[model samples]
Structure formats: C-alpha cells, structure tokens
Target: MSTAPLVAVPAAAAAVPRHVAIIMDGNGRWAKQRHLPRFAGHKAGVDAVRRVTRAARALGIEALTLYAFSSENWRRPEEEVADLMGLLRIFIRGDIDELVRENVRLRVIGDHSRLAPDLVAMVDAAVARTAANTGPILAIALNYGAQAELAAAARRLAERLAPHEIDEAAIEAELDTRDLPPLDLLIRTSGEHRLSNFLLWQAAYAELLFVDTLWPDFDAEALGAAVAAFGRRQRRYGGL
Candidate 1:
C-alpha cells in the first residue's frame, strides 16, 4: 500500500513551500536505452537543471536543492567521473553569467577536498559572483552523501561536547544543512522509490514525489505538476 498522505491546501495560501529538493536519477539508464554513452545522459541532465531552476524561480520558490553528485558516484568508472567533473566546470563557466543575470544565487554543498583544485576554484568563483543575487537560491549537492554529512555533524557535535553539552539542539547546530530550511517537497526522477542517502536528516517530514521521467527529459511541465501536487497536500507537520 502507498504510504503517501492525502492532505489539501488552498492555492491562494501565502505559506507556499519555501524549499524544494530533487534527486536527479536515471541518467545512465536513459543513455543505455539509446545505446549512447552515459555521459550523454549527464549532458542532457544539465539542460534539465537549467529548465527546472528557471521554473522554480518563476514559482516564487525561495530555495531549490539538486542532488547532482553523491559520494558513492566516485565508485563509477574513472573516465566517466572525469567527464562529470569536466561537465560541472563547463556548466559553472558557461552558466554563471546567465544565472547572475537571472538573479539566482548558486550555493554548493558536500566535501570538496577530493575535487580537482581548478574545478573547486571555478565553483568558488561562481558562488562569489552570484552571492549578491536576490532571487531564488540554487543549492547543488556535489560529492555529497547524507550519511557522511550526518556522521560529520555528529563528530563535530561530539568534539564540542565533553558530556554536558550533548543535546539535540547542539547536534542540529553542527549539521551542514543548519543554515538551510527543512525540505518542503522532495522529488525524485526516473521512478526511483528510495531516498538513496540523499537528505536523510533534512527530509524527515518532507513530501515525497516520484516521476518516471528520466532526468534529461524533466522539464517545466513536470515541475509544475510537482508544485501543484504539493499545493493539494495538507502538511500537518506531525499535528492534527
């Protein structure tokens, strides 16, 4: 049986969701179905990113988080990994100016120590360039793993507490997503039905929406449907 809730909210409500998170899945499968290389699907997925970002901004969404690259992706073929990094660099260099023009602020999360120095530099430059934008914030999770993030947060909290300082608030303060709002709607593309360690802590009570469309094929209409579905949800937040 489906575990999804059936709550309803009016369309005119001013309290629309402030954050939307997505797990872009099915890139490799999309490529395989076409007898093309996996990187082609990834390239196409980048185009979807642009479309979704534009759609989110138009919908008055305050923040959008995209699960781009996870720590587990490092286990993939070396050449594919290099190509993904290259694609990221290309996107940063090619899209920053346009993103700034659109008033979008680009923020990245996850461990960057393993990234190539040049790529890291480009990401940093892009973030700095778009820092002053007043529009919707775009957060890309690269080399990110929710489990690792939580473990890291726990370690930091443990370091700060001898014994007396241990508390939920303290642990929350140490989390990497502390500065970000809790997830409002979490969407996963490619028909996947699992969290896959995307945002385990932050998505505790988020509405989950799944679509069978591949990441590369995701567009504005699909995004609109997700928002509309969210509008019909009655978010009790653990209350009646």
Candidate 2:
C-alpha cells in the first residue's frame, strides 16, 4: 500500500548535501494567490514534504530536517493553528507506511511539553516505530526555536557537567542536532533570505539557498537545483 515515487539519480553521481534542512514557507501566500483558504496551501505543502523526502533519500542525503512548526507560530489564530496540527496528524497517518517501506526513519525535534497529550504520544510512537530503520533520517521540527534549544542545552549541561568540564564540545553535544551530521545546506522557499531562528549554531558553516518557489510548488527539481548550488559553493570554515 505504498505510493512513493521512484528516483533514478544515484547519490554518488553528484555532491549532494548529506544533511539538508528546509524552511517550508509561503503556504499562506500560495493559498492567498489562489483565492483559497490557507489550510489548502498547508495541505498542498504536505504533499511537497512527501516529494522532497523521497528525493532526499534517493539522492543519498543522510538526514533531512524540515521546519514544520515553530514556537512563534502559536501566536496565530486558534483555528489556524489547530488546522495545521490536524494536517500534521493526517500526514503522519498517511505516510508512516510509505516511510517504513522505504526504510526511512522519522524523528521530531523541539519540545513537546505544550502539545496535546495524545498528539505527543503519537509523535513518540512514530519515532519509536522508525528507530531501528537503517536508512535516511527525516527530522521535523515542531515548536522549535534555536535560541530556546541553546538555552535548554546550556541549562541541562550546566546541571550535568561541572564548570571545568563545560566548553564548546559539551554544549554542542547537548544540542538538538547533536547526533545528526553537521548541516551542509539550508534552504528557504518563498524567496525568504533569513534564517528565522531555525538552526543558528548548526548553520555556522552551512550554505544557504533561497528560492522564490512556494513550499506547495517545491518539488524534486527545485530540491536538486538547490543541491547543485550548494555543490558549487566553497566552504572554508574560516580556514585558508
């Protein structure tokens, strides 16, 4: 019962980003342009998530991180936030089987303390189900903010490690992306040029790409183009 698309490009064929993060933006704008409700654009954006995920795996990306819901998004209208959460639920329910079949693992970053009890449970269960899969990783950031993550890491490490043992290494180990590969390429759709507090620490050396295409219209071709751009960049990491 899987409907995943086929990918013909092998990972070895190009310099694909091993760890790619995308800020899925412009859902509301995409809807507004079409004279439809914002929820429709979000629903279409979910389809883009599916397509990009498949493309990421096919291109041999080790991990794909998506900016799903941010902490600041809670300030939106109550009905809109609820609809977005509902779409997330539908996405997981519809795509879990396809992900499992493709041997891809699912992970959700960010704190779940404020989420509904049942929704948190569902996320936990999905992560558990995909934990043992030995394939590409799909990370979704829900209610995540880089500043909050850094603050939490600092607090946790301060309590766990003595001041003498605390350093950049200790803090990095406690970050949300500690286990994932260093971010290589960061992308934002809808012509956005800012990070918007997504992954400040991890993106220290990442190549950023901003595209005019809306999230709902982003497909494998757009993703591949971004990767190509990343491949052309020279990352010095402050070295000669």
Tens digits of per-residue lDDT for model 1 on 93-123? 7788788888888888898667999888889
Q: What's the CA error at residue 84 for candidate 2, in Å?
A: 0.6
TM-score of model number 1? 0.91
Candidate 2 has its poorest 10 consecutive residues by lDDT at 1-10
Each model's lDDT: 0.84, 0.89
Candidate 1 segments exceeding 4 Å error: 1-15, 162-164
Residues 80-174 of candidate 2: C-alpha lDDT, one tens digit per residue: 99999899888888888788888888988899657888788888888888999999999999999999999999899888788899988888899
The Cα error of candidate 1 at residue 224, in Å, is 0.5
Predicted model with the maximum TM-score: 2
Clashing residue pairs, backbone N/CA/C < 3 A, model 2:
none
